[model samples]
Target: MLYKTKGIALSYIRYRESSIIVRVYTEAFGLQSYIVNGVRSAKNKTNRIALFQPLTLLDMVVYHRDDRDLHRLSEVKTPYPFQHIPFEVAKSSLALFVTELLSRTLKEEVGNPHLFRFLLTSIVYLEEATEQYENFHLAFLLQLASYLGFGPENAQEFEDQLRERSLPFLADDAMTDALNTFMSQPIGTPVRLTRAQRADLLDALVAYYRIHFDNLGDVKSLAVLREVLG
Candidate 1:
């Protein structure tokens, strides 16, 4: 059967001399792999390979077979053109980290419209915002935790008292209020998070993901992401 859907490029692996296998998360199909033939060949190489870049949002028509492990793409185009995500270093790094995390964590063939929408919105927000890249990544991790069913229940888990007191950056009442709101509605970005708070939250999120996802081994890109954000 042939199907049309919007997909987010997750990761790709080189196959043979001129072929590649790309994993993508789609709105209609949760996770799917497509094999592109002659991607490195002289004919249409640039256009064919450009659609598979990390975190690229694509509208595609694919030929799916019930018994086949790999599918084929008949047509592809960018569904939402990014303004700054690919060009900006911080935003690009964040996108890469998030895509890697999702590519590993989401392991189902079933459709998830809500998760798809959340990711699309997040990518848009990351592209537009200038300040608060760390906050954005932290918020994304927290929000993802809820979807993955391991979000924290209290703010204390995401705080370091010694640093909090020493810096006097985040007010006690403000942190408390934000945590309360976050617990109530485990979606969307928090107002703001301090540098210490961001680190703590990232740790909490990674721990939460590990608790839920048995196969989420040591994330190789995590160190690179930390370096980018730090």
Candidate 2:
């Protein structure tokens, strides 16, 4: 059946001679995979493949099937085209990290409108933000955990939960303060932290996520994100 939805492009892999299979997180259907054909053909001039860029916000009409694991896209376009994420190094690196994180964590094949709205809002905010976005990914990770049902309310809870599982994590005063800020404040709020501090906090956050999700292996974009943010 055909459905209209807003989707966030997560990732894609080349399928055949001229097609690709893209994974998208949609507002109406949670997460889905669609096989798009002819996007890479030499005769194609419209560059339709650009719609699959990581974290791109798309408006789509799709053919969904309850019994099938893969589906098809009848139409797709970027309604809120990013203005800075693709052009700036720091923002682009953050986008990459966010995409990888979402692809790993979001696995449900059901509608999650609230989670989808949060993701959409965060993506647009990151794109338009020119400064004070260094903490964006950290904030994003913490908030996303809440939607996944494993979020801690504060630094103490974070440490306590890890300790309960025999996972050693010691958050110093600075890291504690940063965690509290990220957990309590909005994404646009600024929290001052040096490059090294931010990197350490990110490692801690990833460890926290690992406790809840067994397969969230090494974030491939972490090194690049750290270098770009530095």
Candidate 3:
């Protein structure tokens, strides 16, 4: 069956000579893999390789079958082209890191319109962000956890527990408040945190996620993001 939906590119791998296997998280179908034929062919101008870039949003029409591992797409285009993420080094790295995290965090191969909307809005915001964004990924991760059904609703309690147990930076009141504020606020909301503080809170959140989700291993982008955003 053919279906029209909005999709956000998560990741893709080169397939054969001129083709690529791309995973797009769609509004109609959650995580769909499509083998885009000739997307990488330098001689072909019709098919776009940029459409498969990490966190690029697209409108797509796809062919689906029951319980199939791979799918086909009939049409795909970016309705809104990113203005900054493509050119800005920090934002580009952030997008790559976020999409990689999403690929691991979101496992279900079914429709999640709410989760999809949250991610779509987040990517747009990240692209347009002009203020402090060193902490943006941390905020995004916490909000995404809510969508994944294991949000840190009362991080203050956990902070106190960590302090009592003498768990590294959690013993610091400043770090504890930073984590609590990040857990409770929306993605765009600003919180006053230093570079070191932001890094600490993010490290804690990443540890928490690893404990909850078995598949979320070491995020390679963390080192680069910290070096750049620091």
Best by lDDT: 2
- What's model 3's TM-score? 0.92
Scored by Cα lDDT, where does model 3 land?
0.82
TM-score of each: 0.83, 0.96, 0.92
- lDDT minimum window of 10 residues, candidate 3: 162-171
Task: Name the 10 consecutive residues with the lowest summed lDDT in model 2.
Answer: 162-171
Clashing pairs in 2: none
Q: How many clashes in each candidate? A: 0, 0, 0
Tens digits of per-residue lDDT, candidate 1, 1-230, equal 88999999988999998889999998998899999888877776366787788888999999987677789998888967778888888888888888878988888787889888888877777877777456566667767766666666666644443234342233376656666555555345446666565555456556656656779898877777777774
CA lDDT of every candidate: 0.74, 0.91, 0.82
Candidate 1 residues lying further than 4 Å off, grouped into runs, are: 152-190
Misplaced by over 4 Å in model 3 are 157-171
lDDT of 1: 0.74
| Residue 29 displacement (Å), model 1 | 1.3
Residue-level lDDT of model 3, residues 22-43, one tens digit each, is: 9999898898899999988889
